[model samples]
Target: MDGLGNYLAPDHRRCDDYFSAAEAAALQGEWEAAEAQFNHFLAGMQHHFAKEETVLFPAFEQSTHLTGGPTEVMRMEHAQMRGLFQDMQQALASRDANAYAGAAETLLILMQQHNLKEEQMLYRMCDQMLVRESAELIARMNAIAQ
Candidate 1:
């Protein structure tokens, strides 16, 4: 009912939870569990990115006609996170705890910053500017598989 922030903020938390679980497992040298948890985290993150890039950003751009604004910044940040994801994936494949930990630390910082921006600014803008379309927009986001 609150719109974009209501929908996406919880998703950020869900993905962070998976990320934390994966990191904890890796730190404990639980490779099998770490892999499973990391896979979940990765999939969740990819889905979130897809929804924003495909659905939310486009809608926001069309409504606001602000193509070169916060959404653009968020897109770039997404690319950075994807690169980190690749690093984490490679470390996970090798079961390298040290490498994974290093990547995870960077990723955690990136994600926290990114989520704060979305929750505090971008999502609020979407909620206000796209009020009429909020329900359908949120429904579309929800339909994305985690």
Candidate 2:
């Protein structure tokens, strides 16, 4: 489960699928299913974030001694993403279809673009510079995720 080659791409697809499912469910007025799928999507996101934040990002930081790298930006963006997710959760809780749909659309864009950047640039950096230090932990995290 290489980060750039397989793991990250697959994770991107999983997120895409969940977001699609959630959107469809919401469009169909299946509020419960939509809510469930959204929750599941959030959980999946958190899991991947954990691997990056705890293992991959730390590996980069330790190797380069540079804190304000892509990972730092990613983490800050994650906090913003979480705020959006929280709003989505509240919308879901209230069964506000309009709000939920809007938030979901925004989140879909945010996550997709974020994943693209990491896969294209940041993950490549990890592979090039920190692969030896990061390889084992990243693989282990991916394994546990699967």
Best by lDDT: 1
Candidate 1 root-mean-square deviation in Å = 1.1
**How high is the CA lDDT of each candidate model?**
0.92, 0.79
- Native-vs-model 2 lDDT? 0.79
True lDDT of residue 97, candidate 2? 82
* Candidate 2 least-lDDT 10 residues: 1-10
**What TM-score does candidate 1 get on C-alpha atoms?**
0.95
Question: What shift in Å separates residue 40 of candidate 2 from its native position after superposition?
Answer: 1.6
Query: On residues 62-128, what C-alpha lDDT tens digit does candidate 2 reach at each position?
Result: 8788898778999987887899889888887887889888988898788878888888888888778
- The CA-based lDDT of model 1 is what? 0.92
Q: For residues 76-133, could you state the per-residue lDDT of candidate 1 as single tens digits?
A: 9999999999999899889899999999999999989999999889999999899999
Clashing pairs in 1: none
- Local error of candidate 2 at residue 96 (angstroms): 0.9
Model 1: residue 3 alpha-carbon error in angstroms: 1.4
